[model samples]
Target: MQFLYGVQLLIMILMPLIQMVMKAIGIGFVSYLGSNLIIDQAMNYIVSQMSGAGAVVQQILGLAKIDVAINIYFSAITTRMVLSGLNKLQDRKRAQVWRAPGGTSIEA
Candidate 1:
């Protein structure tokens, strides 16, 4: 249980950091391309639009990352809870069943 929670927490923390790094890398690539590749008016307009579009994309990616983290956290918690409940029920079932010393069923 502790290990599971620890992993989940670690993943949640790392997700945003990863997202930020990826966004930075993408922005860097775009800026490098924009500076090196501009040729004419149309190209200039396109590069400017790309810069603006990158901002919008970064925001969308951030929101998407958040959504993915939330879904993962919820899924992990819900799955653990459901599986633990099933295990408890199974234990109860085993306890209720009569068994002989040799592991044979004992008819009541």
Candidate 2:
């Protein structure tokens, strides 16, 4: 982490890998802050599409709840980013399992 914070060394060594980590970090922050309005809306739409999501959202939203408008703002941001992180983690795990006998794919 320290190595990447220095621009000169980062471009040569850590740039490629760091880009993804940076993106995940950004998405996480964006979803956390509810700053990414369109993304949050899209997430709500997707969740609503799911069969059990309506009831689940309702149940979760009902108890120990904050204000309606505030809840919408908070929920929109958090749910999407959390889902995105989970999806990425699942994909990474799948890739790990699919690797060849030697572990890594290339001669790095």
Candidate 3:
């Protein structure tokens, strides 16, 4: 848990550090990344999955956008990772929560 906190903190701290570098480069790096082909592909994939959800949603609510869902998905996945990592990190709680501890360690 503490380790995951460290990682999340590291990510949050580094984002601005990196963004500062991009800003120094004279092109708003946010806009640069936003215009990337990979983003387009990811957004298309998410919207396609929403359409597959099959509920006539877009007709009734014309605002079912992929950007919102993608942000939600990112938060959900990141939270799941950090919490699950923390859950496994607690020595006393590990056996209760996970089938194995020292999961990547053979010395156990």
- Candidate of highest lDDT: 1
Error of 1 at 57 (Å): 48
Which tens-of-lDDT digit does each residue in 18-100 have in candidate 2?
A: 98899989977876576567656765775565435577666766563633655586676668767887898888877444556
lDDT of 3 by residue, 1-108 (tens): 899999999999999999888786655455346545555677678778767764676654447565576878766765775577567568555444345546664554
Name the best candidate (by TM-score). Answer: 1
What candidate 1 gets wrong by more than 4 Å, as runs, is 39-108
Summed backbone clashes in each candidate are: 0, 0, 0
Better of 1 and 3 by TM-score: 1
Task: Name the runs in model 3 displaced over 4 angstroms.
Answer: 1-62, 92-108
In model 1, residue pairs whose N, Cα or C atoms come closer than 3 Å (at least 3 residues apart or on different chains), thus clashing, are: none
| Pairs in steric clash, model 3 | none
Clashes of 3: 0
Reference-based TM-score, model 3: 0.30
lDDT, candidate 1, residue 16?
Answer: 100
lDDT of 1 by residue, 7-90 (tens): 999999999999999998997688557644533444456446645667778588567685466456556765775688579768
